[model samples]
Target: MTTPGEGWKTPELRAAEAQVDARFKQAQDLANRLRDTPLPPVPPVDFAAIARQVERAAQERDAPEQLKALKRKVDAGEFTWEDVVSGKAAQDPDVQAMQQENVNKMKQAFQMLREGMAADEIMAAQDPRRHRDDGDENPPDVFTEDKW
Candidate 1:
């Protein structure tokens, strides 16, 4: 290799320098485009509040009396967690009401779904509106009155 001072000013060095200059220009152009482009606004979220709520829920579940009481209630009755929360055992009326509301909502949804399905089946069978006429397709020979 040529000495450092002499090599720095040579045509090869100038070419290498030019290449570096071009790369720098390209990088600057990319940076400029990135700067000009608009980005979506960050979501407004309370991470601290979410963390505190999670911690509180964990503490409530881990509390000695609460866990013991919950277990005692479970042992005393044939009840799931939902029943414990909603069935006359919940100390807090608000929690009881919320759980009962949830149970009622689920029951209502299930009943509505059953009714809807029944109505759909009934409509499909009785109503001529949505019924389609069969083209030339016929039953297989196995379904016909034939010797087994």
Candidate 2:
């Protein structure tokens, strides 16, 4: 049987292998240091200060031109009672209750819309071509069949 080449046991090859092992050990030590090191605490966000800044900005802003552009629409009766009622201008208790009610209605509408879209995707997945079965029966109707 022929012996393996002498280069396999050469000084350079052995040095390269030792260098790789040393680099791996260094990487492990770095990882351990990072894992043990405590991260700096995050500073708290000042929402009240941000709100004051926003209020100040809005008060100082030159919005007359923007308001002037909308003045025509306001004068032309394009702005309806419902439009203003949905905004912050209507801040009474009754208006707040109405806003909450409208928000609930919108949430329900969006949830139904999402469920309908999901149902369509599920119905498409149930198509026979999507997966092959060993002559098994169709899957149960989730809507029609109730566990209760």
Candidate 3:
């Protein structure tokens, strides 16, 4: 009956194994020493306070440029409460331009809808192959064909 260590009986191999064991023991001892060492105390964190500050900063950072400009104008007292209430503040060139753009987009969408309905009607009337029953035809069998 042969043993597992029978092939490792050589003196050179034994010496190599001893060296590896010694290095492993040294590494374990170092790890144990590090585990016993004292660490610096960590300051207590206020997570809720940090989260609130982060949210406020993000809201400020993510505000739109136009909104920021409006805020600046309001803060500078360029317009009175009556101007805002009476819709005079909305008469700013930028606001007017944006409203005009929205109106133009709505007009274009109505035009597209009208043109699309006309096109669909024309296609349905003219095209004979619009909705044919494809399942009526038999599919070609590759096994029966000799062209391959």
Best by lDDT: 3
Candidates by lDDT, descending order? 3, 1, 2
Model 2, span 66-124: residue lDDT tens: 33333334446665333433353354443355457657756765676677756444444
Error of 1 at 109 (Å): 43
Per-prediction CA RMSD (Å): 20.4, 22.9, 27.8
Model 3: per-residue lDDT, tens digit, 9-122?
777777887889999999999999999999999987655565455334325644445444544555578764334334577787644554465577567556766777565544
What local lDDT does model 2 show for residue 88?
Answer: 35
Model 1 CA deviation exceeding 4 Å by range = 1-8, 53-148
lDDT of 2 at 86: 39
Candidate 3, 44: how far from true, in Å?
0.9
Question: TM-scores across all candidates?
Answer: 0.31, 0.27, 0.31
Number of clashing residue pairs, candidate 2:
0
